[model samples]
Target: MVTPAYRMIRIKNASSIMKIIGFLYIFTIASLVGRTIAALEFNQMMGLFTPGLYQTLSFLALFLIMFVGNTGFVILLKEQVDQELLRVASFDDLTGILNRRTFVLLAKQIIAEHVKKQKHLSLVLFDIRYGGDEFAILLPEANEAESDRLVERFRLSAVQAGIPEIPATLSVSRGVVTIVPDQRTTLETLYNLCDRALYDAKGNGRNGAARTRIAL
Candidate 1:
């Protein structure tokens, strides 16, 4: 969803300007032709050529062209802006991971499917408290940039963890990493166990990984 201000700004792009200019140019030509024809007939009826008739007609045509072109340009540009905003708003800029909102949506669908088929899935939630908020406060100018680097480091840590290299589905927030393990263990069992493992990792001093066992 694009904010109104963003949409307004996108409407000011060069493409929109060019489009408006093109439409107005065509409108100007058509209006001039129509005005010239009407002026000729009106002058004939009055038996005299009006001094400023052509000038007045030209001004009116210009105004109409501007009005219609500007309206159309805003409509088109707003739509484009809205589409781009949707893409940006759904993505997490830090780790290039799916944002929390999108992840939850996906989780719902996965849960429903697993319920129907009696399959298992695992979720691991862990927080990395090392270099947390203090690091951010220290580098205020480059906060997001540093956060991105930190996220990459975390991803590397995840890869190094003893878990088999299944297609790693990972989501990271400020200091939290939630890993969705491969569809091997039941969701209820996996969550409970992995949650404990996560606490164990935290207890072992912070930036580490632990896995929970499913006893089925």
Candidate 2:
């Protein structure tokens, strides 16, 4: 039970609480072994070991078990609950993609980094639903030609996936916008330009993409 509990408390990124828990786990196991040896009358086999030491080990192990069972379980449970809440807040329920709110937040950070690095960034918007649904993709260091190729590949892949309900070829309209990000660039500006390109694709008819490049 203690071994499994120790494994449960261990996480990929170790924290202070994890370190404490690990220490407690090692101490508890050692104390348990000591207590077992004392119980089995193995004390005579070992020289210069006091009976009081076994009593102390037994008491300390019991105390540690109680402490870990109460506080450690609660901490792990709370961590799991917080992670689930974050996942719910950050992702779309149906599509399992980053929702608009998370997208905007991360997009700002990406824009700042790209501006600092003086790199190209591309944003693609398309509808994924049977009739219509919106999804956005951010491509770092992608230029106009690469973005266009990606859009065409995605369009072809969707058609090849072959949804049974659609009698005809699946049509995916995409808006592709590429820019060398600067201090003046913002997610809102990029979104607006991508939206305009999406309108252009829709205007041109289905199964096509519209490309736009921002100078600044």
Candidate 3:
């Protein structure tokens, strides 16, 4: 699945510039050999080979073309490499969701933006006690009912409908934390609250959601 997408995002004939350089070298050597043979066999002087201004300009143009072509090739390779590295670093290989590190980073950024704007921001984390991994959902500009509905949808998707390439054994019973922060709430506080709520959800029956909210 990933292979086709990776193949498409690449430079076409990226090494062609190198081939062109090799061709130029061979052509120069062959031309010199032919010239030497003619001078010896036919007594031709072969004229002065000193390049004129036009010849110098043409040579520079060729060099410029090669330089540009090679630079583009390098750029394409770098882009593909960067994308692959980012994908591997940012995603969970099994679940196809954001990895824990990426989740926190993006959540922090989103919280900061929404906090400044004084907009509605909700965070829902699904603590899958049985599946060995957690699924977190961040909802910006959303209410409690909205957040609950989203989490329930995700739960059904995991438990009933199922994600592609994922086992159906993954549980969606969650510990949820929702906060409408004022001036006092911090990122650490939000994370701790969510974790506690997850514990509460697990403690209850290990297959339900618990919510704790900080008032706006």
| Per-prediction TM-score to the true structure, in the order listed | 0.35, 0.75, 0.61
lDDT of 1 by residue, 57-146 (tens): 567667765686577668768867986797788877876666777765666666566556554433435453334311111111222344
Candidate number with the higher TM-score (1 or 2): 2
- In candidate 1, position 55 carries an lDDT of 57
Which candidate's TM-score is highest? 2
lDDT of 3 by residue, 59-90 (tens): 55456546755775686578679878999999
lDDT of 2 by residue, 104-216 (tens): 89989988999999988899998655768778999888888888788788888987887688676767889889998888888988989998999898899866789776655
Ranking by TM-score: 2, 3, 1
Off by over 4 Å in 2: 1-6, 9-23, 30-62, 145-149, 165-168
Model 3 segments beyond 4 Å from truth? Answer: 1-67, 129-132, 162-170
Clashing pairs in 1: 120-185, 120-186, 121-185
